[model samples]
Target: MTVVLALEKVTKSFGPVEVLHGVDLALHTGEVHALIGENGAGKSTIMKILGGYLAPTTGRVLLDGAPVTYHSGPEGEAQGVVVIHQEFNLAADLTVAGNIFLGREITRGLGLDHAAMRAATAELLARLDTSIRPEALIRDLSVPDRQMVEIAKALSRKARVLIMDEPSAALTHREVEALYAQVDRLRAEGVALMFCSHRLDEVSRLADRITVLRDGSVVQRSLRGEMTEDGMAAAMVGRELTDIFPPKDTTTGETLLEVRGLNVQNLVKDVSLTLHKGEVLGIAGLVGSGRTELAEGIVGLRPATGEIRIGGRQVQIRSPRDARAAGLAYLTEDRKEAGLLLDKNLPVNLTLSALDMWGFRIDPKREKAEMTRARKEFDIRAASDEMRTGALSGGNQQKLLLAKTMLTGPEIVIIDEPTRGIDIGTKQQIYHFVRALARQGKAVIVISSELPEVIGLSDRVLVMRMGRIAGEVEGAAITEENIVRLAMGLDREEEPA
Candidate 1:
């Protein structure tokens, strides 16, 4: 393999606090490199520097043996380097062809020529073996369709180096397969791919090399198969991870949660379910499925006509506070928007739900004690108690969010995409934590898009499709094909069983 890009002791920092210590990374042509680390570990910082989103504090970046520094994505684009972020950059209102050649539109030696751009975009999609219509508006497209356009956009720039972060989070098995084929095509074309994901299974299949980041520094960097996941996980966390999820043997009581005639807008229609004590009920669905809305409605985050019962007692919940008071908790799908107060500190975020639990006013000792316990248990690393949570890595921030709701000790918890943007190590911790919650006799509901995660954690599974429960398939029927079939509105068994 030929060296495509290399970082020589690159160091990046923001203000007085250093986010990334001196670190080195290298990638060769025609290979997929996996970057693994905890949430606050400096993975994004390194990628940002390479992609020209941020300048390195020290050291150098070399592209094919030539030292270079970039000031923006366009500058990097001029050098054939592109970073496709987790959030799709295409404009929703624009047509696929328009987004592909947004800035560099073809012209008839004068003004913009729509004909040429559409023709070119159509060819590009066809080349990728996709039947996506270039004239179709992105707003009407699916997540997978949007991703395919993004991939086509990258190729339009002739991107030599591509960075994919959590590409599989919103994809189904079939979509993932199509994406993998595209990735292989890119790799075969001598494009160097640096991928980041929380899914170790993906890393095991795709990456030709792996680099482990821990505490703002490089812990291990080696060719493919040189290190095992167990070894990589230990290095990334700087400790032995005996069990990601704690063993659970706690037997649940009788049916602890019951829902009836739940009806909301297009997100959730008439639906109902029952959850037993100490049961982890998994809700699997594709993007835009009714799973999230159902969780929200049950917790009173959204307006709905439904009856929610805890331990056979009917309760009235109209707001988040009402939900908490009713012994229920919810972790939102979008962490930035719903789960966290990005500007706050770890203690403040962790104690968000249980402020009253600390007594009148704010007892310094009790508040500190509560925050300290969550920090230690969740393994949230920060410079000090005074440090802001926003400065932490994505993984640590997510952990603090988990600590936020669970601190209240709610009887039933609703968690949406618990490990979406986190790292593999953090994901492992969450799997154990969720299982442990059920073990402690908590009725836990996990809304997820990942099949493996749902199957691994749930005691029962509810599959949703198009604002309704498509089918309730537990134990013997929770296969990947069935879950997705229900999620995509293909399964015929309806009626919200």
Candidate 2:
């Protein structure tokens, strides 16, 4: 195998602070090289350097055993290098075909060739086994569909070197299978692929070579057979992660929140549930299974006809303000878009929800004081408090969201996708935080797509399928097998004819 892309003695610095410290990496053709690290561990910086989105402060980018310089990402793409960013880079108003062929349009005669582009886009989407239409606008698609589009766009570039960041983070189990097939095909075709994922299982299954980075430096490098999953985890965080979940609270107290006959448009139908003090309840479901919709309805983010009782008193919560007044807080699943003000500073975002408590005059000193406390409490690592909230790593952003939600001082909290797209180390922190909330006698409801997370965190699991609650599992019964059976309707299928 030959090295197609190489970074030699690379060091990257942002203003006064240095992020990457004398890093070395190599990508070979016909191989999947996995770059595993904790969030903000310089993995993205490395990817950007290789794909020509950013230049190294000091070092060389070698192509075919010789040094080369690409002034821009497009220039690198011209040399068969493509990058699929973690944050999507598509025009929301454009059609799927339009986005795929945005910079390089297929022209015929005088104007744009709409038919030809649509046909080509359809073929590319078909390769990924996705049903997204080429004519559909980007804004009309789901997160998983958007992810598939990014992959299809990269494929359309005829990339020789593809760098993917968290490609499977938003996808469902079926979509992941489809993606795996494409990865295998690409590997067979001699494409050098470098992917970064928090899922160590994915890296173990797909990677031919593994490099673990901790705090901007490569800590360990190994071949497929040389490393175990536990070993990789330990190397990434520099500690033993044998116990990821906190111990489940055995004693649940009196019912604190109750919902009866809840209907959220047509997405959720007659869903009824209860949350008791000192209990962490998990909701597990497939995509479009109405798990999020049910949460939204309960929190008044969505219109619903239901009976919601808090502390044995029926309350009318037609909006988020009403919900907050009724002692409830909801953490949205889409953290980047809905949960945080990315362009604003940390202090502004952290206190956005609880601004009413600081009186109408708006005190900046109080906000800064609270942000300092939040940083220490939530373990939100960052270079400076003045930087944009968007610059924080995924784990830090999630922690900030948790802190913001907690500041509302609600007794009942609903967190959706609590640890999505974060490192294993951070996942442990989040799990413990959820348990800590439970131990404080606060009723918590956690909704997640990962079965293992649901099983580990929830004292009781509610499995939702197509706008309805399929079943519930508790204690020893809350296994992945039981939850999946409910989510997939396998239990119903197994019933007597």
TM-score of each: 0.82, 0.98
Q: Write the per-residue lDDT of candidate 2 for residues 393-445, one digit (tens) a residue.
A: 99999999999999989999999999889999999999999999999999999
Candidate 1, residue 243: lDDT: 55
Model 2 lDDT on a 0 to 1 scale: 0.93
The global C-alpha lDDT for each of the candidates, from Candidate 1 onward, is 0.82, 0.93
Question: How many clashes would you count in candidate 2?
Answer: 0
Q: Which 10 successive residues of model 1 have the least lDDT summed?
A: 243-252
Model 1 ranges with Cα > 4 A deviation = 13-22, 87-153, 225-231, 238-243, 266-269, 316-318, 343-370, 384-388, 407-409, 465-497
